[model samples]
Target: MRSQVITGGPFTGRHMLIVIVAFFAVVIGVNVTMAVLASTSWSGLVVENTYVASQEFNGKAAAMRAMASSGISGDLLLRRDVIQYDIHNRDGSPAVVDDVTLTFRRPVGDREDFALALTKTSEGHFEAKHRIEGGDWIVETVSRRDGVTVMHEARRIDTAEFGQ
Candidate 1:
C-alpha cells in the first residue's frame, strides 16, 4: 500500500481560490440582508398601523428644534371659539412637512387618532379644517421634512366648552 500527494496546476492553488470566493459570497449575502433589515425604517415597527409612518413627527421635531434654536417664536393656538388649531412653519421658508396627524385621548373617551393633510396657506401658516369635541387632549403631530419625520404634540384644556 502506498500514499501519494499529487500537486497539479489546475487543482492545487484553485481550491483555496474557490473557497475564498465562496466564503466572500456568503459573507456579502448575509451582510446585505442584515443591512436591509437594520437600516430600513424602524418607525413602522413601533405601531400596528402599517400604512401610517412617523415622517411628520420627524419634521415636527425639526420644526420644534428649529423654532427653539432659531429664537423664532411660533404658536399652536387652539382657538377659543372654534377649537381650531393652527401651526406655523415660521422657519422663514417653506418646510417639507407632508402630513400632520392629531392623536388624542379625550377626557372620557378611548384614545383616537385623526389625520389631515396640511396645506400651507401662507409663508409659514399651515391650516386644516378640523373640528373636534372639547376635552383635555394630548395632541401629537406627525410631520415630515427632507425624508425625515417628527411628531409634535401639545397638551391643553379645551376649555372653550369645558365649563359649559
Candidate 2:
C-alpha cells in the first residue's frame, strides 16, 4: 500500500501544468471543430418534407373553434374506471389538441393532485382512466393547441350519480 503512494517529484508541477495545457488545447480544438461543422451548409441535406406544416396549424385552430361551437359541456368527470372523451374535429381540419393533461385536485384538504395520463383513442379523441375514492376534485387540463383555455375551475361530475 505504501509503495502505491505517488511521491511528488521535481517534474510533478511542470507535468501537471503541461497536462492542463494539453487538456485545454484539446477542448479548444474540439470546440473549433464543432463550430466549423455547425457553420457548414447542410442545406442540400435538409428535406423539405413540411408541405403541410402551415396547414396543420390552421387545421388545429379550426378544430378548437369547432369544439367551442359544439355543445360539449366543460366539466371534470370523475372516473373509477376509464372514461373516454370524444374529440370532434371540424371538416378539413386536424385535432388541435397536442397534449391533454388532466390533474385531479383534492377539493377540501390542502391542494394535492394525481396526474391523469391521456391516450389518443381515435383521430381527435383522448382518454384517461383513473382509480379514485369518492371526493370532490378539481381537474386541470392543458390544451396545447390553444394558448388560452376556454374553461378553468374543473367541475367534478360523479360517474354513477350524474348522467352527462
Candidate 3:
C-alpha cells in the first residue's frame, strides 16, 4: 500500500493563534512580575526635587572641594554594639570637631534608614551606641565645628554581622 501525502502536518490556524497568545502571555506575565518587584523594592527617588538639587550643585561641589583641600578625613567603624568615627587632619593627628552626625541608609530603600548623633568620646573619636543591622549601607558623615560644616563624607560599606 502506498502512503498518502498529508495536506497539513498538524499545525493549523488554531495552533498559530494559541502560539501567539501564549508568547504574549508569557511576555506580559514577566513584565508584570518585574514591575511589581521593582515598585516594591525601591522608591527610585534620589532627591525630593531635581530642580532644587541642581540649583545647589555648584555650591555643594565647591564646599566639597574646599573640604578636600583642607586635608580633613574621617574613618567609620561598625561594631556589634557601637558605631564609631574618627576624624583626622592632614598631618595624621586627631582633628577636633564640635559635632559628628551620621546618617545610615540602605542602598536601594529608605525603610531602615536612621540617623545618629555621635557623642565625642575623645579628641577626635566620636561614638554612638546604636547597633546597625548587618547588610549593605551608605553612611553619610558630617563633621561640624562651631555650627560650621567641616567635612562631609559618604561611603558604602558591607557588614557581615552588626548588633548581633
Candidate 4:
C-alpha cells in the first residue's frame, strides 16, 4: 500500500490571516466606540474659571455652613415618578419658600440632565412629577424665597439604593 501525504488540513496560511484580521477588527472596533463615547460624554471643563472658582471656594463654603447653622435643611425622596422634597427650619418646622427648582444631572453624561420646578404642596413640602431612570444621579435643589435663592444643596444619589 502507498502512504498518502497530507498537504494542508484546516490550518492554512490564509485561514491564519483571516483569524488575525478578525481579532484585530473586533479590538479596533471596541476601542473606537469607547473613545467616541468618552469624548462626547464630558465637556472637559469643570468650571469656566478655575482660579476664580478656587478663590471663591471659601466664601461659598462659609455660606453653605451658615445656611446649615440656621437650621435650614432639606430632605429629598425619590419615588417612582415623583420626587418629594421637604425643607425644615431650625425649630424642626417646615421652611416655606417661594419656589423650588430640582435639577437632575446624570453622573456619567449630560444627555440625561433635566430640571423641574417643584410645586408647593404644604407648608414646607414640595413635590415634582418627573421620571427618573435607574442609575446614579446628582440632585441639586435650589430653594428661593421672593425670587432670591436662599439655600442651595446638591447631593449624589443612587437609584439602586432606593430600590429602583
Candidate 5:
C-alpha cells in the first residue's frame, strides 16, 4: 500500500465573513420581528396626556372612594340590541340620577369606544336602544344628577356573557 497524506482545507477569511454575516442576519431578523409585533400589539399609550391624568388622579381616586363609601352601586346589562343599567343603594332601594352615560371601550384601544346617554325607563333603571358589537369591553358607568357625578364605576365585560 502506498502512504498517502490527505489534508483538510484551512478556515479562510471567507468562512469568517460568512459566519459574521449569518450571525448579524439572525439578529436583525429577530429584531425586526419583535418590532413589528410590539407595534401591532399595543400602542403603549395609557393616556393622551400623562401629566394631566396624573394631576387629576388624586381627585378621581377620592371621588371613587366616596362613591364606594356611599353604598351606591350600579349593574350593567348589555346586549347586541340594547343596553340596560340598574342603580341601587345599600338598602336595596333604587338610586336616583338625572342622567346616565355608558361608555363602551375596548380593553386595548379606543377606536371602537363610544359613549351613550341612557334614558330613564323607571326608578333606578336606564336603557338605550343601540346595537353594540359583541366583544371584550371596558364599560364605564357614570350617573350624574344636576351636572354632578353621583356614581362612577368601570367594569370589564364580554358581550357573550349577556347573550350578545
Candidate 6:
C-alpha cells in the first residue's frame, strides 16, 4: 500500500490567514470605535489648569463652610420644562436674595450646558422655564445679595428619578 498524504483541509494556509486577518480586523475596529466615542463624549478637563484648581480647592471649601455656617440652604425641584429653587435661612424662613443664577451642566457633555437666571416667583421660590432632556445633570445654584455671593449649592439630578 502507498503512503497517503492529506492536504487542503480546514487548517489550510488560506484559512489560517483569513482567521488571523479577521481577528485583527475585529480588534482594530473595536479600538477605533472606542477612541472615536471617547473623543466625542468628554473633553476631560474640569478646569483650565489642574494645579490652579487644586490650589483653589481649599478656598472654595472654606467659602462653602462659611455659607453653611450662616444656615443658608437651598432645594431644587425639577419638572418637565421647569426648574424650581427654594432657599431658606437658618430660622427656616424663606431666604430671598437679589440674584439667583442656575447653571445646568450635563455629566458627560458640555454642549447642552446652560445658565438660567431664575425669577423670583414667591417669597423664596425662584423658578425658570427650561427644556431639559432625560439624562444626568449637575445643577448649581448661586444666590447673590447686593453683589455678594451668599449661598452656593450644587446637586446632581437624574431625570429618570422623576419618571421623565
Among the numbered candidates, top TM-score falls to 6
Task: Find the number of clashing residue pairs for candidate 1.
Answer: 14
Error of 4 at 31 (Å): 4.9
Where model 2 places Cα greater than 4 Å from the true spot, the runs are 1-79, 89-95, 146-153, 159-164
- For 1-164, candidate 2 gives per-residue lDDT tens digits of 35686766567778999999999999999999987776662333222456666657787677667656753333344445765554434453435455566777665443355777578665556777666655455566654545555322345644345342
RMSD of each: 17.0, 15.5, 3.1, 3.7, 3.8, 3.3
TM-score of each: 0.40, 0.41, 0.87, 0.77, 0.77, 0.89
Instruction: Give candidate 1's TM-score.
Output: 0.40
Query: What lDDT score goes with residue 149 in model 6?
Result: 97
The lDDT values for all models are 0.54, 0.57, 0.92, 0.89, 0.90, 0.90
Ranking by TM-score: 6, 3, 5, 4, 2, 1
TM-score of predicted model 6?
A: 0.89
Per-residue lDDT of candidate 1, residues 1-164 (tens digit): 99998865565667989999999999999999988876652333345563455656687566778645543323455543232334444554444454445555453434344555556565435655566556566555555555564335556546454442
Best by the lDDT measure: 3
Clashing pairs in 4: none
User: Candidate 5 lDDT, tens digit per residue, 38-145?
Assistant: 788677888899999999999999989999999998888876787889999999999988889998989876678899999999999999999989789998888998
Clashing pairs in model 6, backbone N/Cα/C closer than 3 A: none
Give me the runs in candidate 3 sitting further than 4 Å from their true place.
1-9, 161-164
- Between prediction 5 and prediction 6, which has the larger TM-score? 6
| Per-residue C-alpha lDDT of model 6 across residues 78-156, encoded as one tens digit per residue | 8888888889898889986887999889988789999999999888889988888888999888999889999998889
Ranking by lDDT: 3, 5, 6, 4, 2, 1
